[model samples]
Target: MKARFEELDFQQTPMGELMLRRRTEVGTGTDIYEVKLGEEFLMSSLFTVAEEQMATLGLAAAAGDELDVLVGGLGLGYTAVTALGDPRVRSLEVIDALGVVIGWHQRKLLPVSPALVEDPRTRLRRDDFFAVVRQAPAADAPRYDVILLDVDHSPRHTLAPSHADLYTAPGLTALAEHLNDGGVFTLWSDDAPDEDFHATLASVFADTQAHVVDFDNHLTGGTSSNTVYVGIRQ
Candidate 1:
């Protein structure tokens, strides 16, 4: 099974020990993939409906309030790039825990997305996502109007157990602290949400809703169901 480019096998990730590879076909570059635990499919560049929707919904919920945005994950840089496409966005802070992923985007992966990787309004931060949220200032002015998270497959089933904190009571409070008045938060999960995650959102925001979107993934030649949860800070 040969594609235009070869899979670049690398280190293990928190989700599982995995290899990174690029997919190309018909002399055109496709996207990248992370093969987890040698069998489970992780993320790929082929389908990005959920990633794009996360940003789109977040911005719409913000209702022109978000000048600066903080995206919790930098997967394929889709959400970050999509948010940056908006002229109203003054700044973007993209936080990812894995420095290697960032390195790949800066080096091996930039050719596929030159414009997004080199955007002037973007700031890439290498740190644990929750820590960044916790450190956010309590002051009103500097808060992020929108917070978009695409870091995990779902709240119930996470790649990292430590991430559960982000869906907990204290975590919800921390996230709320960083949100400006009437701001919005969007979370993307590969699958449906569990009851606890749903309740957690209800506990955190004034309004909450689950949105389902269809995805046509080009890499695997399959259709997948993706869901997003939206929370508005009252």
Candidate 2:
């Protein structure tokens, strides 16, 4: 049997101290992969229902057979891999601010890294998602059919102060500008449904909704829920 706990990789990133670790549960004997940013827990392979759902729900609402998708975060490669699973997606670009995070995938350090790196439709770009959307797209830029954002914890709870603006009305409007007609915007939030954020999405998009996704929590012995907010541009 493998060791009880093993640190896979560690790096000092601009965002903070990034670390990946694998631990085998004593009872289940399942190896669980986890990511840590500084001292706070960021993501875990054990629970990624909402991250996968962000892509599934977004692409399901998209109105095209061939879709150009944009993913605003690439944590453990769950969201990006899920998006690529759909045959309707023609292209996918994932934007992440931390180069070290991207390096983990490029080096095939994570389980889903192989799928994300081998896919022809996927492009992992090292850049700030908020910064990219905050600026106007170039004249020749192709508008995205669906945009999946899984950066911050929620609209109000952000990893950094700079990310808070993207959850606002003006920031959402800028995000909408990058989408094609009938395009969809999906966001994964750790918080429960936020009425204020829903209202802000409604102000910027033609339609909006908050979907609560439930997943089994091994540690808690009960199911936990995450909110996925969808907005459609007309």
Candidate 3:
């Protein structure tokens, strides 16, 4: 018999209704967690290989012993936790637009929440990632060695309409200002590799590459792919 799912937490944000749920897999008897925004599925514990890879790949491309990282989304805390795993990462600032998502980590509701909260090197900041990137850096602002973003569904598809501009060349240029010299910028997309988005990145950054991350989709019983775009600042 298929195990039943339980709603762990739910909240209403400016974006939409947010919910966190968990269920046990019937065959494996392992808990599967999911986050949803309204009727749209945001993330699932069943497939986190791409999310974890976003951090590992981004950090590897960034050259530095003492690295300061910036993560644009805190979904399930997988990327944030993965970044903290690196001994070279001196600090990680995770920025999320939704406060409820941050609360999920602070309350230790998500599976990766415990590790994220207990890590002193990680700091969760509630702010609009696009706005933060678009604004001029303050005198005390700290430029990151690498900036990993996984907020939008894709460059063409976004959770919010306002996020579409962030994928553009001009918007990407603004975000590049937040990175140090030779810094890396990585973005995770639910869709497959998009050449148009790659062109946009290439126009703004010195070097750009798109990586296809494939993982098993339990729901479909087949392999599914996501794209990770990596750009390096000069």
Candidate 4:
């Protein structure tokens, strides 16, 4: 039998210690890929339903043939790859604060790295998504049709405490300015549906919806759930 566990890479970033690992399940023999920051688990291949849904549901809300998408956080490249799967997506700019995570994809360390690099539509940008949104747009700044964020654990819970502002009214207003008219903003949350966050989005966007995605949890042997919050620019 193949080795059950392997550590692919480890590095220290401004946020914390980031590690990429791959493990094979004993019973099911499923090869699972995971990324962790410090002691917290950032992402796992075992649960990506909500990630893909963030792309599909957000893009579906955008009205246009050629769409430009901005995906915050490049964890495992699941969300970015899912966004690229759509033919309507003309360009996909994935922004991640951690350069180590971006290097994993550039070095083809992860399984999806090869595909992510080969896709001409996708561009990996090493920058803080929240800071970029807060900044004033350049004269020729490219407005996106949809912005999908998965960096924070949730609106209330964040990897960095500073990220909490991004979900507030003022922060949402700043992000909305970077979107094209009627563009969509979507985010993945580890927590269940949050009415307060939903209200915050509603206050900024014309329409908002929260989707509860359920998937089987191999660790707990039961179902797990996540939330995908989507907001449309006016």
- Which is the leading candidate under TM-score? 2
lDDT of 1 by residue, 55-97 (tens): 9888878867338899998867778888987888988988988
Residues 98-201 of candidate 3 have per-residue lDDT tens digits of 99899989999888899999999989999999889998798799999999999988999888888888899889999999999999999999888898889999
Provide the global lDDT of candidate 3 against the true structure: 0.93
RMSD of 2: 0.9
Count clashing residue pairs in model 2. Answer: 0
Task: Please give the distance, in angstroms, between residue 222's alpha carbon in candidate 3 and its true position after superposition.
Answer: 1.3
* TM-score of every candidate: 0.85, 0.98, 0.97, 0.97
- Residue-by-residue lDDT tens digits, candidate 2, 1-234: 579999989988877889999998888898889999999999999998999999999999998789999999898999999999999999999999988888889999888999999999989999989999998899998799999999999999999899888888999999899999899999999999999889999999998889999999978999999999999998
lDDT (10s digit) by residue, model 4, range 19-103: 9999998889889998888887878888899899888899999999999999999989988998888999999999999888899
- TM-score of model 2 vs. true structure: 0.98
Error of 4 at 201 (Å): 0.5
| Candidate lDDT (C-alpha), each | 0.78, 0.93, 0.93, 0.91
RMSD of each: 3.2, 0.9, 1.6, 1.1
Task: Estimate the TM-score for candidate 4.
Answer: 0.97
Of the two candidates 2 and 4, the one with more favorable lDDT, higher being better, is: 2
Predicted structure 1: clash tally: 0
lDDT of 2: 0.93
C-alpha lDDT of residue 26 in model 2:
85
